[model samples]
Target: MKLEMLDTSIFIAYVVGLLIIALWISRNEKAEGRNTEDYFLASKSLPWWAIGASLIASNISAEQIIGMSGSGYALGLAIASYEWMAAITLIIVGKYLLPIFLKNGIFTMPQYLEQRFDSRVKTTLALFWIAVYIFVNLTAVLWLGGLAIQTVAGVDWMFGMIFLAVFSIAYSLYGGLKAVAYTDILQVVLLVFGGLLLSYLALVEVSDGQGFIAGFSVLTHELPGHFDMILSPDNENYMNLPGISVLVGGLWVMNISYWGFNQYIIQRALAAKDLKEAQKGIAFAAYLKLLMPVIVVLPGIAAVILYPQLTSPDQAYPSMMELMPVGIKGLVFAALVAAIVSSLASMTNSISTIFTMDIYRPLQPNKSQNHYVHIGRIATLVALGLALITAQPLLGQFDQAFQYIQEFTGVFTPGITVIFLMGMFWKRTTSQGALSAAIGSAIFSFALKFTFPDLPFMDRIGLVFLLCLALTVVVSILTASKEGDESSNQSVSLDEVSFATDRGFNLAAIGCVIILTFFYVTWW
Candidate 1:
């Protein structure tokens, strides 16, 4: 793909304008009076709109824009289970998980674990998350962003990584989550608009200049097989998203771990002004998730019809973008860049928050708020620096970056999800049991991967989750305290009222479930 002068100018202007807007909104946060709460949690002052936009922006990145589209080209509509299932997952998290985290006034997921289990559990998971964010999550996003830039603008890969890292760190480091969340509002807008435009144009081209509706009709009628949401056992992509397992099995494990417990994605809701605001924000994000396939997945399907001769599925997104005219091309490119940078900023902020709050502050207690805030900024730089250095090598290991990310993260999700679920609902769960479950789950996941290399990764995750759940239960029962033992009551109490649902939230959640059900039934 070649970029003309006008396209280059517009892209540059869009990036500079974003930096200016983000910095301008965050100026107050960088002032002298800014403290730990203000920096790390945005002073817990974000409203529903900001929270919702930030959640979507943080969640959608090059992985979805590039990697998922690549999957769409290869695997077809079945790949959208990730996005569609996430809509229902967000609702579950809002109704069931957000209340618990909010009631505890926790700043991070590990902090909630600490309250439920012990410091050992908190510190262990906190370090684990820090390592994953820097090495896996952050590195993957940087590498994909660099690859996109290289594909679209013909830029050097290393330079592209440096460029994205610098812009993301610039506004986020000084202002923290405040800047990241607020700027995400604009990022989401650009992402949605640009993504839709790309899809619309791709469809138009595929239909030989006919409108989108006509193109869509042609696509469905001509490529009927590509529309299957449930894959058969003989299908090539069934291992990644197995037939019914996507609805009932390991996909749920992945979604719950990501939407409910992941620090980067959940931190937006944690920053909401109140529980009501947080739930509303989550519902709003669910609605956005419903629209994700239109922008992120459909273009890949269209590319199959429009550019059938292309050799690589990863080239689908860039090949489609190259079809756009000059000014529109720039806007769409800006949107892609927006998706990359917003996600990078969110991850960087979350890593800093986890390290500073969960690890550093606990080890060095009684520090001033300013001291912690300063340390957080420094930690942000270190995390970004490590990601810049390691992204290229780490990304080179996989042919499909999206599946690589999911498969690797799957190893940890089963154990983490089981531990969190038991710790939250079952008062009998002990810290020792939680710790044992965590360690055992990792070993079990690796054993399955190596021992049965041909087993579907999704199926392995399902098996691991069940095994870990049983392990947790047996360990908890054996370690239970005797009658009249005060230590037995030490577990965090689950307040029934915290899990209560209001009418508005209930209606919204029901609506989300209905919509998701309709999509699956219609597409099936």
Candidate 2:
């Protein structure tokens, strides 16, 4: 049970690197007139490729790299369903979902919902997403990043928490969307490289005289059913209670909302130079998603083969890092730091946007734009503080770091995804429909969460997702769009974004879907 934790040298180097990067990003954000638009949407100048890479990196974070892989280890092959499903989701977003978004020149997903449905719907989904990303996802994000920092860098968690909060707020608040997007591009590169290094190291450990296959032979003999698609219900394997259905369903619901609808993530794509470039960004991310299992998941599987007696799956990932070859330790540490900072920076920017645009600016319509920008910065700092404090209770609380976060996200995602979808394409969808889906999904998820708390609540995302969809459709059909508002418009243009890059991106996206489908059938 007692093992060498982590080298303090590696941890220290990572923190130092993080500081240098954060300061560098802050400098870039200060370019003249980059104020409002620059801070919010990266001045809408982010090319599709930058937005795409950033989108993937921002979405991956510590949760996907560390936590999700931990789940892959715990659940075996079933957890991989998330990545597989996510690829398809992006395709749908690119083809069916995006035209509506880009066409309206919408700033936030909520804004589009407001115009198509009602302001009340916009506010409701906006508030729900805020709670999920900020209160729930944001807390875990900081905590996990802090945990990684503490393990690799040597700062105590309380201090680590503060360090993450301060650095994340400093630049994200200062740079706005521009900082987050560009930094995301940087983070994605680091994350992918880290994944490659980690996989190579793991493969080397397993290989013997012949190399990879020889090394892989050890796992086959050591961990029976390590590759099992169906895990026992009583066991920790992903197939346990939620089963393959939830695996498929949970992933379907989450990715659709995450890639297609979530504002913070989508905003990156929205800033693309053209539709083609936007598509490229998304396809690039999908390609990366396919590779993640090899990086994040395989390690966990290898950990089980190598360190089977650890007695806890959560220990699997950290155990691998502690045992990695010394020369490569620094790279892993650097990559981990990148993941943490990228996520922290993202959430900080998004929460600040919500506070300023959704709540404050509306309330104070007469305020100078300059004054509003100042207020946005202040709100970012406050959010960082709250997130840090919120993360405090989570410290050392959950045995499995990732699941704790997913369960929380599942509750809010169902409602947010439902309302956003209805409000976007369905003109007949009324405020009443949006309200019901949001309120209904939240109430239903809450009830189920309490009634079956320890169960794989991923089904919770699906349950309310289905319900909200049903309610939205039924309500829209029943009440209809306001008499004069026109409920029957069905053609949303593919060129809604009107940017230069999107068409090429669409071609790339189609190619990605083809590749992903091949994988799905083969994997299936």
- What candidate 2 gets wrong by more than 4 Å, as runs, is 1-29, 208-210, 229-248, 447-456, 481-484, 488-524
Please write out the lDDT profile of model 2 over residues 321-390, one tens digit for every residue: 7656664676676677677777777776776777677767777888876777788788777777777778
Residue 381 alpha-carbon offset, candidate 2, angstroms: 1.2
Candidate 1's TM-score:
0.97
- Clashes found in each candidate (C-alpha, N, C closer than 3 A): 0, 21
Worst 10 residues of 2 by lDDT: 488-497
- Stretches > 4 Å off in candidate 1: 482-491
- Determine which window of 10 residues in candidate 1 has minimal summed lDDT: 482-491
* lDDT by residue (tens digit), candidate 1, 121-170: 89999999999999999998899888888989999878999999999988
State residue 168's C-alpha deviation in candidate 1, in Å. Answer: 0.1
| Candidate 1, residue 392: lDDT | 81
